[model samples]
Target: MNKAENIIVGISIGDLNGIGGEIVLKTFEDERILDFCTPVIFASIKSMSFLKTHFKSTINFHSINSINQVASGKVNVFNCWKEPVNIDFGKEDTKIGEFAIKSLASVTKALKNGDVDVLVTAPINKHNIQSEEFNFPGHTDYLAQELEGESLMFMVTDTLRVGLLTDHVPVKDISKHITSELIEKKINTVYNSLLKDFKIGRPKIAVLGINPHTGDSGVIGTEDDDVLRPTLKKIKDTGKLVYGPYAADSFFGSNNYKNFDAIIASYHDQGLIPFKTLSFGQGVNYTAGLNKVRTSPDHGTAYEIAGKGEADENSFKEALYTAIQIFKNRCDYEEITSNQLKKAPRIERKQRPN
Candidate 1:
């Protein structure tokens, strides 16, 4: 095929020892998904075949040597490597981490070169993925350096969306990192993401406080009152519907999160804990505010359930749907903006002057 009729979803198999294989194969096992998007898993055919059998999936893979052979309505597995590799289920190995990096790099290259429309990555063992060439804390950090635009780690489900002010940062340093500039950047990123990716108009964003109960008016800590409050106020003054400095503790418990289009958290656990509790397998970790579209399952590599059929493929499936939808939305936005520019209003001259 000269061009793909449907969007091409690039799959990067994360940690071989993790449940990445199970979830990836299980998601494609259902033939119905091929109707809208063509899935191209960036791994060897041998590895995919093994996973299909290991997970007992009935998926039939169309092995392709390159991206040009990727046809719609069938699952395609690009041969990233030909040689047989070791696969020990539930065992963490740095060697396995190397393969994860290989798959990620290959798929990311395909996305950057415009071969693939969007990327859906499986979970990786972040600790083992660190090396000389790839020292990223996670996929979001790595992608920010590789792709254009400011990246925000946006975790989303149908009803709820959470973006982090600080991701993959240590708890002790999170306070120092939540500066006015950082808070404003993350909030704007989330705001723009809701408009562009999620297709929401006039997005109302709420930001969680840095300290507990918003520092209880400087009793617990002053970062929330001093830093977060001022930054959010500054952003709100710009005519955006951004809110909060909300008490992270009671916001979700009281269901106050339902009032906003999106929520920005001070750090990782503060946002993800509530999000995962509410959505978990039903959610997708989307890297928003980027030139290229990328998403992943909200959960991490479940080493305990690696290669087991017990692993749920819901999150991975959701990630796939989210990526395809966002890609289309971005294209629509571009076309709409372009047409508006071309159809700009012109000033009419008076007939008397003529």
Candidate 2:
């Protein structure tokens, strides 16, 4: 809603023991990035100071005790916790996970309350960040519950976009989850997301088959033949430019995905594997179809490279840019649609036989 440069980006410092801190600090290391958006990092000054010292970073931070104190054109560090936290790089500790939760919970509330215009999350350890207070599979699932509208894990780069039908489900249970109704829901979500979020008009979408070679035409499995085929037909009949049940194996291999605006994979690995293969270090994990905007880098905690000062900040920077752009796009979309509705010509009835 705010101007592009003035938009507030609420950030969550992810797992302390991982590369979350490193990447986040590195992304904003260039002060010019502040020209695009104001960033508020939800973590204590103490924790960030520790990361700064360990990484030997020279970047300065505008430390604040609350969100209201956040100022534009500087990296604002809000103290989610006042106390210091122990940081052992590459080690997985549940205690550190609690701090990650504090950062995430506070920023999420800020996003809900409109304290922040958009959210750009750092990578959290999916395992360690699990407890009674936060028990979702990942950020997408948690955000789906907190935010309005269904959520879809839409992995994206500038040229490529891939959405998963079943993000966190196990492979064995994937088929049962991919019903006719779900196909419609996920497809519609992606379709609308393209129109509103990505500014695509008359978007073309493609769906990858659930089974190999689309069940070998019912030889390997019949779910694709029975469920996906008919559901896709119904969607296509409704005047949507949706197509496929295309063989997942060759969709990306042959660069056939470039033909469509978006691609929907039946399950997680089916889509992510190729997406990462193509844009591993540059992709963003966008939570599309939600009222509030959120995005994260394609990479994870990267415990292997934690504390090494060797992490690349491209993906995190890309996520930040994507979140801001999407927020602006959504705002523009609402305004345009609302104005069209207001300006629409009214029809008046005439009495013929009076």
Candidate 3:
């Protein structure tokens, strides 16, 4: 598909009562997003009306019933829910949880059906949305199941990209999940994605150790020595520029992260703490290893300042830009790979004999 032929981005409105709707309306206020792609939000008409009234944004919203109704150069919205419900700005309700899940499901289906090119999600409240119906931990797991792929969550800024081995796990249980196979898989996924999606050829990756001082050669812990070390060796054997099990505490301080295209952490906080510290309000959470592109602002729903017109739209804006860039990069990478494969046999014959 041509770049200007209108790329459709399916957006899942996070929590109806939180800043999701506000940011959705605020981010689209710029005509730039429409310049790159057509953004279609799966939300309620009532929710959009509430955000326009609350945020005082002058952006126009065109609600449609189906994906085919989407129009280029305008903000198209798919009304997942039509009924009006009382919104307690900054408060959580079970009804809002249901609405958020419904939006997610609709967008996910659209993406799977090739109706949309990418999916950009707003932040959802995990605590308030925990129930049998919404059984997954968060969007990552939900998307993993729906897309039927092994997904890795990565936080990205312009300079650094960090991926977690275990996201949303208890601090104590993190070590249990850090197996050699899992680490190898995460590394391969990160490596392939960098080459395919980000267009980074021969990308260098840093792997963070689970313990302090990289186990200090077993002085602090054994997992870094036993688990991470072997995994790094296996990845390196494949002729990939992968390094480390670097001491988690000192990796960020020594500017070691700058040496690599991305860092793989043992757990969520290990990676996120440093990433957020570096790009808190500007970071984008990108789901790597999926067939379709998906991203969200790294920050969560800030209910404390909801409806106050105090929310920062920088992260959301970055998320939108990142998605578009990755989509373009993927197209370029595919073209390059396809051409190389077509010429491979000729190059092989030239090397085979005199």
TM-score: which candidate is best?
A: 2
Question: lDDT per residue, candidate 3, 203-232, as tens digits?
Answer: 999988899888888888899888889889
Candidate with top lDDT is 2
lDDT of each: 0.89, 0.93, 0.87
lDDT of 1 by residue, 1-354 (tens): 122358899999998888998988878878888888999999899988887777778888899998999979899999888888789999989988989999999999999999998999999999988999998998999999999999999999999999999999999999989899988788878888888788898999988988888999999999987888887788889999988888999999999999999999889999999999999789999999899999999888898887667889999999999998888888877777789999999889778964
Clashes of each: 0, 0, 0
Clashing pairs in 1: none
- Worst 10-residue lDDT window for candidate 3 reads 345-354
In candidate 1 the C-alpha lDDT for residue 109 amounts to 97
Model 2, range 1-354, lDDT digits (tens) per residue?
544558999999999999999999888888888887899999998899889888888778899986888899888998889877989999999999999999999999999999999999998998988898889998999999999998999999999999999999989999999999999999999999999999999999999999999999889999998999999999999999999999998899899999999999999999999999999999999999999999999999999989988999999999999998999899899899889999999989887995
Is 1 or 2 the stronger prediction by TM-score? 2
- When superposed on Cα atoms, how far off is each prediction in RMSD? 2.8, 1.7, 3.0
Order candidates by lDDT, high to low. Answer: 2, 1, 3
Worst 10 residues of 2 by lDDT: 1-10
lDDT of 1: 0.89
Better of 2 and 3 by TM-score: 2
